[model samples]
Target: MSDIYLFYKPFHVLSQFTDERTDEESPRTTLAEYLKVPNIYPAGRLDYDSEGLLLLTDDGELQARITHPEYKLPKTYWVQVEGDITDEALTQLSTGVELKDGRTRPAKARRMDPPKVAERSTPVKPRKGKGTSWLELTIMEGRNRQVRRMTAHVGFPTLRLIRYAIGSWTLEGLKPGRWRQTTVHMPEQTQKVTLKPRKKGRGEHAGSKTTHKAHPKTAQPKSAHRTPRKPKGGR
Candidate 1:
């Protein structure tokens, strides 16, 4: 079974487990500081500057689906931008704005109140006594810094970005650096594709479909008589 988790990643923390560049004087925080579970890795990336909901799982297939751009999972963000978000900007954002890479897909964008949640360590404030605005933006595709670039292109650069939701999962009841264990049920078709009948051997249980790999160095004993190969389309 896949061990899935919803983690609330805080600001300035890396999505990965280890920080190879860390030292006693200047330490970098990582997921290893929060998550103690073994074999569980982050399914998708949350930038070091960005904060909010992060998905982690041991299932490779589930991780692939969530991270792949082709899947088009809707990610909702509560963004604090430099200036007031106008209706015109929202319209352009919803219609699809041209980016350096290409035109972005039509997204759901609307002006919203500041989200009531845990504050960042390096707090985002209005600069030069200028007013700032909060917005709710949802996008399907995951481009590198797409949210920040989109808001900037629309004339209101983002001050702070918080990913509020990914698909149906939200950051409700989760504080910064906190995580919750959960099960994500896959489709029947996916289940069939993920699980294959395990070959029974000495001291092995029948009908088990474990995903563990065998040692490369440890080889099986060869028989004098050739054994018949099983036909394709596993039983």
Candidate 2:
């Protein structure tokens, strides 16, 4: 069986399990501090300064689905910006924001009341004189520092950023530095259930074909290079 972990990552912690920084005067915080799991890898990197839901898993295919740009999984963030954001800025974000890389795709953007997320382990120190407002912005593309750049392009610099959700998963009930493991259906498995019906079996309803063709072995990257298997039953 494969396992997926939803971690509520906190501010000031590196998204990586190991800090590759060789010049650090002090030990920096990393996922290893809170998560002791072995072998599982984070599907995507959240900025060290950004806080919120991060998905890690032991399944490579699952990881690819969650992280690859082709899937277009929607990621939403609760962003606190330096200005009391205006509708004009929201409209620009909803339409498209031109970045150095290129123009970002249209997004779902709107003002939000202050969110009830846990305070950062190190408190956010906003600029002394500027006012701030919150925005709930959803984007499908994961360009580097995209949200920060988009808000800044429109003259409202991001002060504090919290990723609130990815796809259908949310940070609900998870607090900073905490995590929970759960089963996620592979896309094919989900499709199988919706595509057809089959012969009934004992303890199952009539015309039921819901069971997946279980491999029993742990899930692996479908396209990863591995030694060719000998013929089944070894001739």
Highest TM-score: which candidate?
A: 2
Candidate 1 residue spans exceeding 4 A from truth: 22-24, 189-235
lDDT per residue (tens digit) for residues 4-86 in model 2:
67788888788877777776788778888888877777878788789998887776666766677776778999999997999
Best by lDDT: 2
Q: Could you give me the TM-score of model 1 versus the true structure?
A: 0.78
For each candidate, C-alpha RMSD in Å?
Answer: 12.6, 10.5
Q: Candidate 1, after superposition: displacement of residue 145 in Å?
A: 0.6
Per-candidate TM-score against the hidden true structure: 0.78, 0.80
Error of 2 at 183 (Å): 0.8
Question: What lDDT would each prediction earn against the true structure?
Answer: 0.73, 0.74
> Worst lDDT window (10 residues) for model 2?
226-235
Per-residue CA lDDT of model 1 for 1-235, tens digit only, reads 3446777889989888877674779888888888887776777788889999988777665666667676566899999998788999999999899999999999999999888987789978877967899999999888889999999898999989999998767777678887776654333333222233322222223333323221221122323342222111100
RMSD of 2: 10.5
Clashing pairs in 2: none
What is the Cα-based TM-score of model 2? 0.80
